[model samples]
Target: MSTDNSEHMRTIDRWLAGEVVNNTIGIKVVGGPFDGRTKIVLLGEDGRPPAVIRASGGPAGPSRHAYEAVRSTDVRAGWIYTYTGPEPATES
Candidate 1:
């Protein structure tokens, strides 16, 4: 099986083993303004991430940036999110 598939299976195995898997998942962003950034995002009850994510602008201001999930891939360490662009009016 592919490495990606293996990683997914491991996650399932952990759940089956009664391990308290964390709802937060690591994600590497690709493309868009926040490209090449990595962050930890919350996952839904169904073990899926939100279609869109908002990141804090930190230091620059209290504004937040939005990134739409274009694609995702499972890896041993975490998942990857390919973002397209920041959503309009997402900043504050």
Candidate 2:
């Protein structure tokens, strides 16, 4: 498989594993913005509240916009689709 595919699989795995902890529970970046290149991050320990897990096109790039967007959305009622892949997912 391609690296992108691998990363995507990893993302899914992380999500299912509950390794990701974010205030934006329902808010998921549909297709990882930077393709499979997008990074997955987790904050806090097992039960603590998760902070920001920012993904970007370029490594070391800022995630202010993503943070704002996620915060703006209703994590309980709405979700945010990030444009980070070669092509965005159709079924998000």
List, residue by residue over 1-92, the lDDT tens digit for candidate 1.
Answer: 99999998887666433233577655667665567666556677866667777776644354566766544334443445665444456333
Per-residue lDDT over 1-92 for candidate 2, one digit per residue giving the tens place of the 0 to 100 score: 99999987776665544344352123344434333332333333543233344444455353322432233243332324455323232453
User: Which lDDT value does model 1 have at 40?
Assistant: 59
lDDT of 1 at 36: 68
CA-lDDT, candidates in order: 0.60, 0.40
Clashes of 2: 6
85: Cα error in model 1, Å: 1.8
Q: Can you list the residue pairs that collide in candidate 2?
A: 32-84, 33-83, 33-84, 34-84, 35-84, 35-85
Cα error, residue 51 of model 1, in Å, equals: 1.6
